[model samples]
Target: MENHLYDGLIRYIIKKTRLDKGLQQRDLADLHISDGTISNVERGKVVVRDDTFNYLLNKLGLDGGKLNELVKKEKEFIEHLKFRLDCIESMLNNGYLELANEELKLIHLDEFHPLAPFLMYLKGRYIYKKKE
Candidate 1:
């Protein structure tokens, strides 16, 4: 993906990574970068230097290269995820298990979210319904 592809997702990924690592804002504070700056970056209010971005990722032991692509894909994934959830719920409610299962298969779970487990629940429900 191109650098322009970030489209503010860089902020989202970095911020989420920070949270997942159990590190607080102040924990990532450096001599030059403060917790407030980190907050701004995560909120998309500011863009830090490229080296700083890499350093932050390195601090969390995350690979920056692949992360960029993953974040890019996440943007698309989240959009579809929202709509798919509604469709899946409606299908399941209407006893259209097979159609719901097919729709679920089209979504890629490259990015992590609680929706993953919910999706699995839907799959199991589909199988259970088919068995009955």
Candidate 2:
């Protein structure tokens, strides 16, 4: 989900700021946020609401510029991945198995990337067909 990307970016920034400021998760307790919520947010396991996000940022004494930049980078990464996936799909459709396989190798997806499962499926299909 694109929302996850945005939330993940914000969460990462918040976590980084916390570390840089030497603030522990418990330090935010006065904000009335639970430890589980803080942990989930730090791990990017959940999306934080806008108001709560702003409150967290304010508490961290961080400017929004870093968050904005991270969000922009996230969007750019998604667009680039879409382009690569389209190229791979096209190569496969044209029966250029080798070319598709080469393109798949160039994908450079992170282990926890959202498209990892789809990429795995494509890779398995490619491998299965290659050996046939």
Candidate 3:
């Protein structure tokens, strides 16, 4: 599928928020919104209104500059993550499983701050895949 810039941006923000909080997708879904809505927003297919955006930020316990900063950091962070993931995959393919595993572990340990729950979901995916 063609990637939509807004979708990518939103997804990045969602992920950042989730990671900071250290909660799983289902756990986050139980607190504020549903997993489907989170996925949809991250995909950028759905348009979020200002009220909803404010709600999300507030629910995630963001206020003032931190919230603004997160929005501003979205683009750069997403690009970096994409690049890192590509590198990790390449390493795994080139017999660098140990290195890749190390990198993955770092990601797992890194706190997403307020987005911990969402980050937990991504971590779960990474761990699940590693086990497979």
Using all chains and alpha carbons, the TM-scores for the candidates as numbered come to 0.53, 0.58, 0.43
**Which is better, 2 or 3, measured by lDDT?**
2
**Candidate 2, pairs of clashing residues:** none
Q: Which candidate's TM-score is highest?
A: 2
Ranking by lDDT: 1, 2, 3
Q: Which residue pairs of candidate 1 clash?
A: none
Give lDDT tens digits, candidate 2, residues 1-132.
123425555665567668777889988756457666677777776776756656666677755775677668777877778788877877776788999998898777654455667788778878877887
Q: Residue 129's C-alpha lDDT in candidate 2?
A: 76
Please list the C-alpha lDDT of all candidates, in the order they appear: 0.71, 0.70, 0.59
What is the C-alpha lDDT profile of model 3 across 10-102, one tens digit per residue? 456666677668855666564556776666665566765655555565666765577557767765665676677667767665666667777
Evaluated at residue 31, the lDDT of candidate 1 is: 90
Order the candidate numbers by TM-score, best to worst.
2, 1, 3
lDDT of 1 by residue, 23-83 (tens): 9999989896788867766665666676666666677676756786777688787777877
When summed lDDT is taken over every stretch of 10 residues in candidate 3, the lowest stretch is 108-117
